[model samples]
Target: MPTKELSPTELHLWNIVENNPEKIAKMSIVKLSQYAHVSTATIVRTMQKMGYGGYTSYRESLKIRNNSNSTFNVLNEADDKIRSVITKNEIEMNNTLHNLSYSTIEDSISMTKQAKIVYIFARGLSESIAEEIMVKLQLTGKYCEFHSDPNIIRTIASKIKKDALAIFITLNGETDELVAAAQKLSKNDIPVLTFTTNKAGKILAFSTLSFIGYKSKTNYFPEYEVRSRLPLQIMTRIFCDAYSVRANFYKSN
Candidate 1:
């Protein structure tokens, strides 16, 4: 879909479809347009951007998938649970890829190449992804610092040079400390790049460039606070690989 390239009206229509996928599966193009308060042509264009030939095919596919899922629900419980998890992870990865903007990625790579030093910040599970980025960028011969501590992040944000780049990785992107640090960095005219699963995250306002990944809200374990980090990992892997290629090319040139 590359939703970042969508116009405001298209993005709005996408949000409506995304939030109410099951309901939308039953909707006609005219009905959806009326519901979304946009023209039918807008709805058709939005579906086309999602790689559908038209609204009818998109709705049909969703209906078929829903029917298949209903039929699959009668399977053995344990095997079904495992298969469902795999399916959800696959969908998340696919959605993340579709939402990614190549231009934004290239700009981020260029910014990293120009920076004297890169400061990476993350917490919890995201710290692992940040660490991977730190190590990979360092291997490309760039000076990098990785921090997971909130206090250290704020301190570094205050003291970082103007030419330095700050990359923040967070699942929700509402971390108070990270937002504060991003605000501080922006105040000092430092470029901030953010990777998050939340498109409307507060961190985006302070970011010079932001990449949004997909994370399913399905709670497989309602008893615990576990969620998939696969989307973030996928985004991190792509960015690191692209950065490495660009860095090597520039070095050789």
Candidate 2:
């Protein structure tokens, strides 16, 4: 399933469903919301974000049974575990590709080609993807500024010109610094482009164009702060390649 990074509350609700699927399937939306200690709206929104029509649809989906073995089974053999990991990654990439919009990509490339300057901002693991974009654009003779620091991103956002373009690479897309920067740039009428896993993220509201990517809902390491960056990597590769083609074509003309 194509998934997204969930908020703490949403994650808590998901945990309940994951642990007690039959129980959730039996409960009404109001009952589930009360049991989960969240509002009915939260329940509906979380279900919708998970690709369900609403709470009713999600509950119905839970009722459908699959007799196959659990994908999270602890494999006895090392090779089996390796294959499992590979299979999961393949699924992740496939879902992300399926979610991509060709027209949105073409629009992003066109905006990049027309911008006076391209400002890229990212934090944590997302910085690598932003750097890749910067390097690719720079190689095509486009002037790009890449910032990984939160303070610098906010500062640049405030001072950036109207003709400049801003791209934000974030997994959850709810980072305070990044959202603040996006809001500032948006208010100034700067073109903002964002790549994120969260379709309901605040940054999307400020974005002139947004690319949504799929993230695995499974948290393999619940104790650690690790999450897969595969979706972002795949989307970045596509965007950079398309932008490069357009940039080269414009130069040739």
Candidate 3:
């Protein structure tokens, strides 16, 4: 991850409090929410994420351990900031994400115009997104390959036609493997497009086009991916629309 992803709230919240063990021991969901910028419910969820039942208990555990924490608090807070800044209030974050998602279709259409063979290399959660695109683009009758197997992703990436197009999806964007894969694709002169959560991340330097996704809504009370998933879904629909338009043009031939 980029050094800038660190948040001061995480710094203070995790900082060693040798002065008053009670503050760490007695921290509340409300106080953590105030600092973390996520909902109070999310703070509890954050505690749960750290293996505690809830926020108050999580803080108490910190008291037990003498406070040696790491960077995940910063990561979660950054997720909060992304949601706050990028998502629209009272709007179906899904709709907002769909609006942004069309750009992916636009990107696909542009690539299809040039690449006789298009290779999609993604893994993990991105594999789902890639497969959806592969099916949709196949309707155009253009040759498209979606590979999530790490070996094939790298192997096919190395062997792609020099003029082909490569699209990568890695939300974190700073992941070492994806970065290396992108570097390989770039060397072969294959245009690389990427979708990621952090636009300022290292992947942007290599990607000709990129999109950042953020969560729209959250109800930590019940547990969900409503905020982040909405934006991703939006991208999916948008890409479908753009590709549909391009597919029509191809049909004219």
Best by lDDT: 1
Tens digits of per-residue lDDT, candidate 2, 1-253, equal 4344677788788778778887887776556757998754455556656776456556555655544332222112222233466767776777777777654565567667767899999999888889998998888888999998878888889999866789999999999999999999878767788899899999988886778887877768889767898889988889998887766633544
Model 3 lDDT per residue over 196-246, tens place: 666577876666455566533344445632224445445555655666775
The sequence of per-residue lDDT tens digits that candidate 1 reaches over residues 39-152 is: 544555566678764565566667777784421111122222344767788778777877776545655676787678999999988888999999999989999999999899
Q: Where's the lowest-lDDT run of ten residues in candidate 1?
A: 71-80
The alpha-carbon lDDT assigned to residue 245 of candidate 3 equals: 76
Sort by TM-score, best first: 1, 2, 3
Model 2 score (lDDT):
0.76
Candidate 2 clashes between residue pairs 3 or more apart in a chain or in different chains: none
**Which runs in model 3 stand beyond 4 Å of their true positions?**
1-108, 216-227, 249-253
Provide TM-scores for the models: 0.65, 0.65, 0.53
